[model samples]
Every structure is written in structure tokens, then in C-alpha cells.
Target: MTRTEMEARVRELLVDLAPEFEADAIDPDEDLRQQLDIDSMDLHQLATSLFEVYGVDIPESERADLVTLRAIVDWLDAHVSR
Candidate 1:
């Protein structure tokens, strides 16, 4: 899928994960933690959900690399086969 498609998918995942956040307010370029006030546990849970949904594993060591929406998209883009 294209980057734009990946971004949209990521957004969809985030929306499903955090129903408290207004979908339209999520900034694709902003830090997810800061924008959404998500805690570490919430982040871990979200990552796990993403992996389950996409069938892609994200190592714990690299979890910090996914600090923003763009970062998650980039990680998936790099790890997922075309």
C-alpha cells in the first residue's frame, strides 16, 4: 500500500484504540503521547493491537521509535512487505 494509505490505516487503528480522542483532532505529525495524553500502558496495548491487526511484530527495543503517528506509519512501511 502507498504511504497515504498506510497513514490512513494507522489513523484508523488509533481511532479504534483510543475512542476518547476525537478522530478529527489527531495530528498525523504530532507526538501521539502528547496529543492524546496516552500512557505507557496504553501505548503498549495499542502496539499489540496493531501487530495483531497487521500480523507484524514490533520489537520492544524499537517501541520507542514509534513516538508519533508518522513514526508508526514509517515502522509499518519498513517492516511490512509490499
Candidate 2:
């Protein structure tokens, strides 16, 4: 998928998981756990939800790379793209 599409999907996954936050307000550079009120469990849930949404299996070892929205986008672009 293209980078724009990947970014959009990441935002969509976040909104789907947590509707309280303004999807548009999410700073791609900001850490979701620290900035978005998402906890560690939320991160795990987010990862699982993202895998379900994108049909891609993000390895457990790479979970550390998903700390921020930008990171998630980069991870998906690198790992999920065909």
C-alpha cells in the first residue's frame, strides 16, 4: 500500500480503538501511550486490531517500533506492503 493509505489506515485503527480522541488531532510524531492516553494494554490491543484491519502480522519483536503513529506507519509500510 502507498504511504498515504498506510497513514490513513493507522489513523482509522486508532479511531476504531479509541473514539474519545480526535482522530485529526493525533500527532503522527507523538507517542500514543504518552500523548493519547493509551496504556500498554491499549498498545497491545491496538497492535492486534491493526493486524486484523490490515491483514498483516506484525511480529512481536517489532512491537517496540510501534510506539508512535509515525512509527506504526513506517512499520506497516515496511512490513505490510506488497
lDDT of 2 by residue, 1-82 (tens): 6899888877877876779887788999987877778877777778788778777787889787678899888877877757
Candidate 1 local lDDT, residue 79: 86
State the lDDT of candidate 1 residue by residue for 1-82, as single tens digits.
8988888877777877788876667887888888888888888788787778678889989988788898898898888877
Model 1 scores what on Cα lDDT?
A: 0.82
Kindly report which residue pairs in candidate 2 clash with one another: none
Worst-scoring 10-residue span by lDDT in model 2: 73-82
